[model samples]
Target: MDLQQLPGYLTMALPLLAYAAFLVVMHVGQRRLGALAALKVPLHLAALGLLLRVGAANLPTPWPARLLPYSEALIIFAGVVLIIRAVDAIGVGYLLARLQKRHVPHILRQGAILLADFIAALIVLRQYLNLDVTSLVATSAVVSFVVGLASQDLLGSVLAGLVIGVERPIAHGNWVNVNGMEGRVVDVTWRRTRIETRDGDFILLPNNVVMKDTVTNYTLPSPLHRVRVEVGAHYRHPPNQVKAAMIAAARQCPEVLAEPAPSVFLESFGDSSINYRLNAWTMDYGRQEAIRDEVNCLIWYQFQREGIEIPFPIRTLVAPPPEPSAHEQRQDQIERIVPLLLDSEVFQGVSAPDLLAVADRMNLLTFGAGEMLFNEGDHGDSLYLLAQGRAQVIKRTPEGGQALLATLEEGQCLGEMALLLGLPRTASVRLERDSRVVEIKADLFRELIRAHPSFLDHLSRLVDQRQRANQELAQALAQQKTADAAGGIGQILRKIKSALGL
Candidate 1:
């Protein structure tokens, strides 16, 4: 190596050594490199450019001069690609790793790479080949003006996409309503935004149109979305009563959030009915339709149980049959409940007249599938006798999960111990299908027990036996022991007397 040529030699040697080190790093950390693996193409291009430059230097004088510019141009292009790849790998992959995000906006990344390549090309033409870039720049401006005028819509859409990328008003997986089309954002590109509707159809909206139209993002700010369901009731019912019933119905749905809580607003007084809106919140915007349906169904059942009639329109052509009177409906319910009361073990010792009297006072309520009648540790003031369909008893384990304790079918009773002893409910009961249950309030139960004191002994023994059976079943399923049931009858009798103030 000549001392005078040291600077040039060192400059060439340093880049070669750096390229070799990069190659070694790529080979060693290929798995961890992720998107950086794309650097291989530029690395190969740089190697080819170096080989071409060396070969051109040794060729005939005119040939060496002719090929040198082309070789330098190749090297410049490869250098631009390498710089862009390095920025993406470090900025997106490494910096965003802590946030668990590994993505950069595609438009921004592509634009940056294109801009760098354009600048590199200008450098090669002006500096390396000694061509005047001022003339090229002037011609490009004129061409860009013509292209812009011809593809104004396309340019507008591309600009809109850039704005969207920067603002981030909506993102992938966000549930949004653009104009009238409601769907989840699947992909966003320079020209269009693709949304996947609930019907499994994709809608491609131009970015310009999306920017012009009103966009409702249900997933931004937070995933919690408020859904409203409209319902009508006869004007005869009080506003508070209807509101309470609607709120209660909304709470029964498992999808409805309890923290923000559900609300009911009396919207307006219609010609034939009072229109009300039920507002409920949920994180699942995709299932908003289903949640609304469930809330509507529960409201209908709750209205039926509460004797709140939903009036029909006043403009009917054909005459509809008159609804049954309150007395007639009461008689029908009592008749249905009488047989169920007779079949119950708790009422076995009571006379038929007494059972009929108890049935008359009881109220029959309907519940839809998946509705929770009561939850574990809830304060209970009534007992439920299943008249139709099935229900599951679920006990919450220590690990915050639920275990099936048992299933209750028709003619079976729940909340008996809670009602008799004034204890909190032990487990949650959820209806498996549309079901009906007769509710026996504490006052009615107290009246029955006071009238027929002998029935208490029989009820106590029966309750004790049922408790033991439940404990055994629970122990078998959950592999957990329950409290001892010995002398439970005596304890139950004392608790019943104390609860009822006998």
Candidate 2:
């Protein structure tokens, strides 16, 4: 090992060491230059260094015979890379990716290629040394077989994963539902498939279970789904009325499609209500629950307008609530008179004391479920204030069609427009599901207005635009006759000339 005795060995090893250093430098360059640039420049420089080292080591040298095995080293290197490139052409890694339902990273694909290199290096070693690999191979086989038997579940998982990789029931980036867990497939590793749920939680399903259990892939072909909203309406209203209203409401929504068309089902009947289900189709399944909530919210307000009662589980008692104290009763009575304030246009003219005196004459009344208190077009006798429960105002159109105009809840007042004027009722007033209402009749309101006759000036001016229909028609007919006699074109020309000061 003296320097003079092996100077050629030193010469050959130094260039090879420099070549290895170039490889290290190329690796760093790859990191800094990024994946794309590294492929262009660093690889060329490193390849140049490798060729120079190989050429320098091969030339004749003033060295010992022990050093010149450089020929075998180059041969073995080429053999290994050749075997690796060949195996890569077979696309073993691509097959693995297909089976696992995942995209294989480039580095992992190269690692699969490296398996060929390892075997190639070992074959070169055996060729160079005349060593027997039979005993070593036999011992390794025995050890692997023992390990495989002991870890049966682990082997089973790996084999099942390979099956999934081959069969591809699910894939990364696909939204899937497995055993009720809705999630996006995040990873397909050696043994498990990872799914990340909408709530940002990760669930790892073992390859074996994923292969065996029921799995629903939403991202394949199309991911459209439907949302169901259940509503209960009182049996007093026909099921068809409620269904038509719900379908119309859903159809109006921009998110719901017209092609599929929303449908309603009369599910069943409860003790006091009929169960109705509204099924709406949506392509955005991720927002399925949100869209369902939004549809129901709109339906609720629409039902009120349609006079359909949304029935809930009602807990009515046979015994009434404890009677209120005399003071509470007085306060309640005071609240009843509050809506009568709407009856006063006098409040619009005269100030405080006049309005207070009018409110004082009001009284409250409670009506049970099956009550019809007033009919449409009948004389409006009272302005009613809702205290509890609900009431629906029914309006009849000129075309003889009936529609529910409003649902009055607690603190709502109805008949104000009728009481404001001494006119016939515009709507039929009825108790909606047993309600308590405070009534301020027309006589009391008139007495209040009579105390202040100047209130008429305000009322007359407010209703000035609303003249008799016959008067409007007669004036219109006369104007039309004059225009026709004058000739329609000449009349229009004269009107324009007059307007422009011709």
> How many clashes (backbone N, Cα, C below 3 Å) per candidate?
0, 5
Q: Model 2: runs farther than 4 Å from truth?
A: 1-136, 218-222, 252-257, 271-273, 304-307, 318-502
Residue range 1-502, candidate 2, lDDT tens digits: 6876476676667766776786787677777876433143334433543555455555566432333344454455565565556455445545555555556544345446566555655675567644466766788789989999998877777777776666677877888999998899988866788999999999998878888789998876676677799988888886657888899888877788786889999899887689989999887776777888888888988898988887667855568679999767766666555544544332466545665566555666767764776887777656677767788878777799988877767776666544554456667877776677777766664565567665544544433322222243234334633434235334433432332233
Error of 2 at 178 (Å): 3.2
Give all TM-scores, in the order shown. Answer: 0.48, 0.44
Mark the 10 consecutive residues where model 2 has the least summed lDDT: 464-473
Worst 10 residues of 1 by lDDT: 473-482
Q: 391-485, model 1: which lDDT tens digit per residue?
A: 99999999999999889999999888777767788899999877899999888877788888888888778766765677733343243223455
In order, the Cα lDDT scores of the candidates are: 0.84, 0.66
